[model samples]
Structure formats: C-alpha cells, structure tokens
Target: MDQFILTFLKNASEKNFQQLTGRFLPHYFTLISKVGGMISPETLTSIQKALQEGRLADIVSKIQEVITAAENAVLEVAVIGESGTGKSSFINALRGLSHTAEEAADVGVVETTMHKTPYQHPKYPKVTFWDLPGTGTPNFLPDTYLDKVGFEYYDFFIIISSSRFTLNDARLAQKIKDSGKKFYFVRTKVDSDLYNEEKTKPTTFKEDRVLQQIRDYCLANLSDIGVSEPRIFLISNFDLDRFDFPKLEETLLKEVPCHKRHMFALLLPNISDASIEIKRSFLQEKIWLEALRSAALAFIPCMTFLMGFDLPQQEQCLKGYRSYFGLDDKSIEEIAEKLDTPVQDIKGHLKCLDFWSLVKDDSIVAKSINCVEAFCAVNGGPSSSVVQGFKAYILRSKFLNVVADDAKHLLREIETVNIA
Candidate 1:
C-alpha cells in the first residue's frame, strides 16, 4: 500500500490523475521514509498506465489502500522539563483535554510522571504525546536522561520551564540536539506572572513591559548558560490565547515530517485564525478524497444502493469539522462562557446550510454544483464518466468553505475582544 502511494504520487502529473485529484494535492516526501526505499519498476508502470488510461476502478482500490496508509502514519511528541514547569498542563492543552479529564496528564503538587508516560489524543489516536519525568532532580543527569527515557522513540522534544531558564534545560537541549533530534524550549505560566504584576504594581504596570521583561529574562538566562540561540516560546497553559502558544504550534507543524503535517494540523487546538486555516486545509484534503470515493459509488450500483447520495457523507464530514474548529454549539458555548459574550454573538458567525433548498435549481449549493458541471463540460476531462467524478467534489468543497469561513470569523471576534 505504501509503495503504491509513492508510485501514484510520482505519476500524479499524468492527465487523467490530475483531472480526478484536482489541485489540492499535498506536499510530501518523494518516498515513504518510514516504509523505506523506491517502489519496484513494474509497480510504477502499472500505476501510471492505469491512471493514463482513466480506468477509474483499476486504481481506486490501490488509491484507497495508499490513503489509509498515509492517514494512519504514527507520530510521537515528547514534552520534557523540570517538575512544576507546567509540562503536564501543556501536554493536556496540546491534546485538547481538561486537566481533570480521565486521560489527561496528571497535574498536581507531586510529580506523577516519574517515568515517561504516553497520552494518546482521543480523536487522533495515532499521534501520541509523551509526558516525560522531570529533569534536574538529584537522580537526574543530563547525559543519562535521554537513554533512561528511551529518547529515540520521539520524533521531536519540547523542553519546558515556568521561571528563569536553567543550566539543566540548556544541557538537556544540547544533548537532544547532539543526538540528531529536534527540540523546542518553552516557558509556561505567563498568565500568572502578568496577573501578579498587574495586581502588585497596580498603577504603573504595563502588560507589554512585563511580557518583554519575562521574554528578555528567559533569553538572557539561556544565553548566560551558552545557548547562542534558543527557539523559545512563552505560553500560559491555563490561557493558550495569552502568549506564544500559537507560534509554538505553528513551528511544530512546520518542523514535523510532511506526511504527518495534515494530521498534526487537524489535531491542533483552535487558538488563532491561522491555526484554524491549517485545520481547514487539512480537512479539505479529506473532503477531496471522500469526493472521489463518493463519485466512485456513482459507477458502482451496489455501493450506490448501500451508500446513497453524497449528502449524508457531506453532512457527517461537516459535523466532525465543526467539532474540530470549535465552531459547534457546545464549543461556542464554552468559548462564550470564557469570554463572557452572548452565545448568539459567536454562533451567528456560522453560515447556515439549507439542505432542502440546496436541491432546488436556484439555490447556492445548486449554483455551485452547476459551476462544477460547467468546469467539467468545458474541460472534457477524458470523458463524461470522468466528469461525474467532480460532482461530489464541488458539493463537499462548498460545505467545507462555509465551515472554514465561520471558524475564521469566530476566531477574529475572540481575538478582537481580547481573550486575555
């Protein structure tokens, strides 16, 4: 299955393949690195031939196999730091679970992760977050810590702190780097610092000044310990919108392997409009593939009878999309409570989809479907049978855009009002 994916992607430029997959083709490594090595010559020729001939069913099963392999790729993230640095909280936040949630990392006065512990995201089970035991203890030595924790297991590491950066953090980071792995430095609990400053200094305290002071303090602390340049993030675990959490998320998304990027993007908690768009684009990839699968049913009478119209599938996709984007009613209600804003204000941002009216000739969904038909008509992509492939594609695209727009609008409102 993995080799077949590499073969198809290598041949994606073939006319018939381009017509069916559209322009949203993702960027990925030329070879499946984990699966390893170039596909055999015979497999490549067969895939290219099937695509060139536009024999949809011939390649469709292979298409299904390759998509499954890509979607199920395993990813591991390690969160490492000293005790009381909010590493557990960061892990919980990254996984989008409350501290009190059953599967959440243990958050308390006593350290619970005495050894490395793994937490699988409820939605994206393949992407696991490891809460590593605290470093810099009497028993903790930088040289041996990596081995003790089985460092080779993680794709990347995030080293965290809540106060002035320490020599231990620097030493551990250097070790991780020397081992040929990526590591990020994170300073947590910025909200607590800001609140204390504002309360104690009352009249003269400026939020910007305090934030800069904290930032400079971390930089200077790390620089003094021989870290020439540190990729550091200031984040408040309790308040993701308060600091550099979004930046951290963005950096991680870009740094992870390309095949894992789509899953990583979808799993990101919606804290900024940029992150929301990342999720939107990743979700669109899924929609396109679903459209192809749905279109395939149009040709297969048995499957068509079993799974009627693309309508139900579209509805189901949007339902999951809304939950992921925090645009759903429950998610909006939670945000509304946090912001002290009326639920209606946030909910109003969502563009309603009138499914009944969509079947009518004059409706927006109908109009969009017609546009796709016109596209197929003019292009004459192979033949009319191939044209039928794009019908579901356009329908899913419209619904997805509505969800993306709504999410961005809601995020803008939240940011404008200041979630701080």
Candidate 2:
C-alpha cells in the first residue's frame, strides 16, 4: 500500500501534489507551522516519515487517527474547594445537568463529598469532572491534600470559594503550581451575594460595581496569603452565562493542549451564544480532516467490500454532527422538557434538512452518486469506486454546514425563551 501511494505521488505533477496536499493536509500544515515547537517527538517522526516516503494516503490516515484518538481522549478536571462552596453544583452546571439530574454530583449546605468522586459529562462521557473533598477539613488537611487526592491524575484544578479565597485555597494553588499543574480560583455563589446586596441597597446598588468588589476582595485575600497573580473566575452555579464563566471557559480552551481544546469546545454547554458559536467554528475546522479521511478511505482496495464504504462513513459523520449540536430527537426532547416548551416548537427553529431522513432517502443517494459522477467526468472521469469517496466528502461537508446553522438557530430560539 505504501509503495503504491509512493508511485502515485511520483507520477502526479508537483502542482497537483501541492494542490492536493493543501486540501487534504491543511491541519497538518497548520500544526507544523503554528505549533511546531509543541509537537511531540513521536508525532513529528510519524509526519517526517510520511513526507520522506511520499505516502500521501498514509499521511492522511495517520492524521485522522491522531484526531480520532484526541476526540476519544479522557479529560480529567478536578473541582476542589472548601466545603459548602458549591463545587457539586458547579460540576452539574458544567456538565449541562440540573443538580437534581440522576448523575449529578450531590449538593448540600454541608460537606457532601467525603471522597473524590468523578462525574462523567452526560453528553461527552470521556470528559470527567472530579469533585474533590473539601480542602480545610481535618480529614483532608491543606498540607497533604494534593497527594491524598492523587493530584497528578487531573489535567487541571478549579479551586472554588464561596466568599473570600482562604489560606487553604492559596496553599493548594501553590502546591498545584509547584507540581506543575494548572489551577484556577473560582468564586462561586456570586448570585446569592448579588441578591443580598440588591435587597440591602436597592437604590444605590450596581451589579457591575458589586461584581468588581467581589473580585477585588478575592484578589486581595489571595494576594495577602502570598499567592501571586491568582486567576480567579467569578460565577453563579445557577447562571453560567453571567459574569466570568464565559471568560473562564475561553481560558481553559486556550490553556489546554491543542487536541484537548477541541474536545473542550465540542463538549461545552450550549448555554450562551458565544459558546454555540465557538462549537460551530471548532466543528467547521474539523470538516476538512473528515473529508480527507473519507477520500483516503475510498482509495483503499478492500473498502469496496465494506458495503461501498462512502455512504456509511458519510452517515456516521452526519450523525456525529447531530449528536454534537444536540439536533437529534432525543436532545430536542430534552431541551423542550427543560424549557417547559413544546418539542415541536423547539424543532421548528431548526433550518437544516432532516439528516436522518436524508440518510435513508434513495433519491438523495442516487442524486449524490450522479453528482459525484459528474464531478469525476469534469476531471477526466476517475473510477466509480474512487468517486464515491469524493461524493461522501462533499455530501458530509454540505450537511455539516447545515447542522451548524441549525444549531445556531436553535440557540437563538432558546435565548428568546430565556429572555421571555
């Protein structure tokens, strides 16, 4: 297979190679040019070997494999704080679940989490949020907290506090830093504080001023305890869209490794317009890679035996987009239930063609195949089997855009309901 790929590249003109490589290997090119310093030695070696051997197909396959592995990778986020700081509620919010949801972390005014408990995201199970036991409790003292909770296992930590950042929080942050792990200070229950302030001083109270005061207080506390330049995010567990939660989400996406950033963006709760837009852009960037993978798979000799290959792959990719954007029937039903609105009302907002129906439509399939044949004819007519892959790529790319637009429209509808 490698020999065949090498021979094919050798026969192709340099201009053709450049055009094809630009189309199919855009992600690889971006990674090499933008993140060259951060690429792992093993990954660099694999890419260099593919280039040296002129195995275009293998390179595409390897790139797709790397992306798939990253998508399936486990992301462990630890939520640690003093007891009654709303860590459990924050975890639930982050996972897009109500505190009453079956898999939600237990929330209480008292210390509920006695031990480190991992709660998997309802939609993306590969992403787990660990609710670590309270830091200042006698059972889990600040001094030995990191070792007790197995700190190394977590990709990052969120050290939360209800009021002021305490000495225990500062110590934990320092410890996490010393261990070379990232930690963010989260000031939770800001809604309760704001409510109290509004009630006490309704005439003079300003939400922005109150929020700034809270932030400054938290910063002062952390600074007094010798924690330098602490990154503090203020949030309300009940309202993730308010205050600093969006900025926190952006920071996490930027700070994590490149592959993991994609997972974070994809799995983020579809609460705010900004979040929905981010998800759309991340998935959009991924379409080229998916198309290239489809094209490469089409070139495989044995792929013809696998039920013609292209249709099934296209179906799977479309299904993934549906699942990711919460466009499927189950997701829509859940949203309707949560908003106390009719399921049809929510579904009405969707502007995309029904992907599931299209997958089963014989006419659409025939039209797609014909379109592929026409495309091949314009390029001097490639083999029918090979053309099927190109058809799959084009079809998937078209639907991907449709699903993304539908997701945006759905988000607007939800926002309208929220406003009302």
Candidate 3:
C-alpha cells in the first residue's frame, strides 16, 4: 500500500493530486451511501444527525472536513537545555536551518534566558521549537522554569545536555515526569567528541560502536538518576545525522499522541529519506485544505494572487517543497559555514527549471533569506554579481526547480498509501 501511494505521488502533477484529495471525500460518501443501509445503526444515527444539523455535504465536502480537522490538529513542543549546550543550534538543525546568519543568537554558557524563543516551522507553523533556558542552576527550580516557559503549551519537553547528566538535568527531568509531561534526554556535542576521538585514535574502535557506548553510558546514568526506562538520544548539533536524530524522531512519534505526531515529524531536520517521508506525509495530510482552496482558486475567474507580507505566498508553498526535498536554505547555509564557503557559493547551483517559472524574482529578503545570504557572503561566495542582459527562453517556469519534483513525488506517495 505504501509503495502504491509513493508511486502515485511520483506520477501525479501537483494540480491533479490536490483535485484528487477534494474528490476523495465525495467519492467516499458515495460508496458509503451505496451501502448506507449496511452501516451499523449507530453510524446511521450519526449520518441522520449530520443531515438534520445541516452539516452533511456532498462526499467532497465531507472529505474536506476530515482533512481540515487533521490539518488543524497540530502539536506544540518545547526544547529546553543549558546554555552552551547548543540549544539554539540544535533548534536550527531540527528546523532544517538555512543560513548561519539567519540562525538565532546563541546565549552564553551561564546567562539566564528570561524569555521563551520560538522558532516556528516555516511550512508547518503549528509545530514550533521553543528554546527554554536551562534550569540547571544552583538556585533554579525545574517547576519554576516550566512555569516561566508556559509548560502547558508544549506537548512534550526535550532536555538537552552537552556533557554528563548533571543534578539540574535530573531535577528538570523529574519535574517534567511529575508534571505528567513526556521528556527526552538529548546529549549534544557528539560531533566534537567524534572529532576529538578521531584525532586521538585515527583508526580505533568502530564509530558506530563508540556512539552506542556513549548512548549506553548516558542511558545508564539517567537510569541511576531514577529516570527509569530513560531514553537517551545522542546528537551532534553540528552533524544532525551523525548521532541519534532519527532515533529521537521515531521515539517521539511513538510517544506523542497520534493526532499531533505528524506535525512534530514535519518540524524535524530533513536529514534522510525517512525524514523526508515523514515531512511529506504530514504536509500531505495538513495541506489538504489549502490544496483544495488552491484548486478552487485555480478555477476562479480572476487572477487571485496568493500574497503574504512575511513570506510571499508563492514562497510559502516553496517552503513546504524545500522541507520535503531537503532543500531548506538554512541547511545550505550551515553547510557553507562548515566548509568556510560563502553562502552564495553554496547557492550558486540554485537555478530555475527549464520551463517552470513560479518565482518572478529571486531576491531573498525575509529573515530566513537574509540570514542565509549573510552566512554565505561571510564564508566564501562572490562578493557581487554583474548585470547580465542575456535571458534564457523557457516554455513554462516553475516556482520550485527539480526540488519541487521530489516533494511532489513524496506527496503522491502519501496519497497512495493505505493508512486504513
């Protein structure tokens, strides 16, 4: 079933795929009505109530309603850690950051972060990354930190540590557990450990085994702290995929309730095919409303442009595409920062499709764009560009380039899945 969905997604164009989503509701109702008599009496009663309440619509409307409900149900999460544990940096990686300059400012090693910094997902606004100050202080209390950050808003807590599990870390975890909130321990700075170790032993034990040993050590330590069945995730903010990002994601998805899990998955870094699949599925589910609205607008008479002040509406759509295809500009910037290349040098390959021109101008000016551009310039991109009069003639220009195709494929794959 999953294969079928993926194949379908890969073949279908964006326009048709959306239309299919809308049509799905009506088609479902038609089939149900055909066997309406066979439906259980309880369901029949509900159907009659839907009709009486004037809430019953054609199959299409019913499907839209279901999709809308799914889309509206989003999860909010809080990421808490000690200063210098790479709290902001981790958020950048998890949110698939674009440029180092666009990256949020990292607080000091011991400074108290008074305010809650929220980095909402570009495509999935419902899923947010809240960087809460580490409550591991001599006088700081875990409960107080939770109150300061409005713990009620988050569905769960992610406790980050750069080194060993301190007393404060254990205290924070205990408080979260007592408050009936889920918490996961993420050991940051794994990349530094790897680099340091490699420098000492160029060809020592296997890297995988070494990582597993570190994870085991943390898990055992947490257990000793009375965090029974504690799940310790090792991650390198510098290298998102090097340690346990995927495992952490899988664990969270399983722990979080069904309704909110999809959104949570969507906010993670686009590190691998599995991550891309998760983003694709969530967006596929969440965007049904917008997709239908877009389809409807497509048929509308006027050229009703999709506009927004923060991110251009077209750019908004492209953002989802970026997340799904792992084309996030922030990720690009991070790469540039690591390699000491100018951000523009990294983005030099960003070109339009042969025939699709969804973007009229590529002037990136939003917070995400400016940050990325600045990072590249600082690293090693061209200082400037000369005006060129030559223009390439293309039949149709796309908003996204080949990257869009990858996203479209993922979307179609989700559509073809048999979740039931």
Candidate 4:
C-alpha cells in the first residue's frame, strides 16, 4: 500500500496527494482490499457506512454549483446622462456591437430613451447595461432620478457628457456616492474633438496637449459642480482603442469586486493588444480550477470510462475559452468582416485543434487518450486511481495552454490585419 501510494504521489503532486489523502484514500483502500479479497468484517461495515453516506458526489456537485454561479454572475451598469450625450452609442460600444446592430441600444442624435432600457452585452449576457432616460428634463428631476430609475438595481453608474460634466451629473454622482454606489464620468465623442482640432489647427495642435486640455476642462467643471476628486474618462464610441478607454477599463476592473472584475475584463472588446492580454490572463487563472473540476468529474462512476478521463469537460472548457477570446466561427467571421480579410486567412493562424471539431468528435477524445496513455507508458503508467486523477489534471492543463496559445495567435492575426 505504501509503495502504491508512493508511486501515485510520484505522478501526482503534493497538492493532489493531500486532497486524496484527506477525502478519498480510505474508500480507495477499502476498494482495493475488497478487490484483493482481504477485507475484514469490521472494515466491511465501515465501507458500508461510507457507501451509505455518499457525500463525495454531493460535495463535488456543490462545488460545481458555486463555480457556475460565479461564472454566470450578473453585473448591472447604469449609463446615465442628459439628452444627446451619446449614452446609447457608448453602451453599444461597450457591448462590442455597432450602433446599427440589432442588439444595440437605440443610437439617435436626439434623446431616444424614455425609460430605463436594459441592453444585455452581446458576448456576456449576464452583464446588462441600462440606458437610463435623459436627466434634467421636466419629468426626470436630478434629486429624484435615482428613485425613478431604480438606482438600487445598478452595480455602478456611468455619467456621460459630450462636453463638460453638468450640475445634474454632479448631483447624480453625489447621490450615487451617498447610496454607496460607484460612478464614473465619461466625456464622449472624443474622436470628433481630436479630428476637428487636427483639421483646424494643423501644425499648431499637439494631440497630447489637446487631450490634456479636454481632461482638465472636464475635471474643473466637475469639481466646480461639487464632485470632489472627479475622475473623468474621455472616450469615443467609434474608437475604443484611443483616448482614455483602456484606462477606464483598467480603473473599472480595479474598482469592481474580485468576482465581477473578470466579467468586465472578459467582456471588453478585443480592440487593443493590452485588452487581449488581459483577457488571456483572466482565462489562464481559471485553468487550474477547471482542471480540478475535470479531475473530480473523472472520479464519478459513469465518467470514469470516458476516454481521456473527462475529455468532454475539457473540450467544453476549451470551447468556452475560444468563445471568450472571440475565436468561434461566428466571432471569427465577424472579425474577418471587420478586417476585410477572408475567414480562412484568420483560421490559418490558429495553433491548436479546431475547437468545434474537438467538441463534436468523440474520436478526438479517444485519440487524445491514446496519446496520453502512450506518453504515460513511456514515463511509467500512473500506479493508482488517484494518480490517474492527477494525470487528467495535467492533461487538462496542457490542453488549456494550447487553447490559450491559439487565442493569442488569433489576436495577433487580427491585430496584423487591422494594421494592414
């Protein structure tokens, strides 16, 4: 038994060893003893009690439930501003949808929103952006605006303005602060401002100088309106990679709670290399958790017979990674259309197995198991069931790394196309 455990730990790490020793080792020993026809009556009664209890599956299921809840967590954001402030356009941009897209908020020069309209993000449906009605109107008063719009529903507020922040904006900010909710000030249509400045001033205009002036002007106005230490982000609905969009994204991620920060970072448009890398890191952090989940699933009776020890779970995980990185067929087509490049040209840059094919084909799972088995045979096959769990964990980690690499490659391909 000691030799078996030593061989198992040789293949498995100390972490997995500790987990198995604490949770499954007793049952494993009983199972082995029964198989070897050496079970005493006392041990048999204990095994029967363990079998009757059956808490392992329940515990694993509860863990899975918690993980699913975290992944599907909702992030409610309120986009509020006065009339003609490009609030809807900014919401559309945040969702990675064009103004004319069917899922986009109504983007009109006039105030189109009469009530609070919730727009679910195209990629992350749980992340809802509410396009609140224009403030400072006869019906929507600043003092009672929070009550009218049900401000309690929002996780955070974004106060937008095309020019300087208004008194209404400041009041809303103060109200949000009083309610213990965070708010951000966004100066929209910055691309237009920069373009006009460059066109009119030519050699005399410095881009950085113009941007700084705009920032200072917004800050001063916001400060005058009673918003202390005002943080203003300048952005353009038409161009997310420019101006202060990246900084705004970073700031929001830092401000939001830990569980919801991934939702914000993952849903951000794949516009810049920094954004892509942020998404990559976010996904990378989940690999270990996913590997453990898959390993646990492999210990389930029906799942134990599956090729590659829970390859379906691994395939599903990789599929999700592909979707999050915008590498699925639909997303790829969208990128290709946006870049004016053929879909095949983008697909050629992928470094891993085709994501859809891997999920759809069982033969792929068998082939993967065969490869793993061959490799393990050369390295000395895992000596026990616990060692097999560790083997599955390692295999899943390798597959995650491969999928991540493919995502990075696809992002670089998109970037190259954009530059060209």
Please list the C-alpha lDDT of all candidates, in the order they appear: 0.68, 0.72, 0.54, 0.68
User: Could you estimate the TM-score for every candidate?
Assistant: 0.73, 0.82, 0.59, 0.75
lDDT of 4: 0.68
Q: Which regions of candidate 1 are displaced past 4 Å?
A: 1-70, 285-309, 327-388, 408-420
150 Cα displacement, candidate 3 (Å):
2.7
Of 1 and 2, which scores higher on lDDT? 2
Worst 10 residues of 4 by lDDT: 31-40
Clashes of each: 0, 0, 30, 0
Tell me, by TM-score, which candidate is best: 2
Total residue pair clashes for candidate 3: 30
Q: lDDT tens string, model 1, 1-420?
A: 122222332233233465433321222223222222122335345544665565556655654654565587788999988898998999899888788878788998877778788999877899999988888577888889899888899999999999977888898888899999999999998898999999999999999999899989989999999887898899999888668988887788767765577677778888776677667666665554444444444344345412234567757756776767766666778789868989887665567334443334234445434544443444444333333344445555666667777777777777777746
Q: Answer with 3 or 4, whichever has the higher TM-score.
A: 4
lDDT of 3 by residue, 1-420 (tens): 112222222223222344444434353243221212122344334434443343323322443444555457667778877667777777777666643445454544556455577877766777778877665645567657777667778889888888778767787788888889999888988887877778888878468877877888888788777777877888877666556878887787767764555556656665565666555444444333233233232223452312122224445566555654655675556555555668775455554221124333444223223432432343345212100100100101133335545544433433344232
Highest lDDT: give the candidate number. 2
- Compute the lDDT of residue 39 as modeled in candidate 2: 30
Give candidate 3 misplaced runs (Cα > 4 Å).
1-62, 107-115, 122-125, 201-203, 284-420
Query: After best superposition, candidate 4 residue 203: deviation in angstroms?
Result: 1.8
Better of 3 and 4 by lDDT: 4
- Candidate 3 lands at a TM-score of 0.59
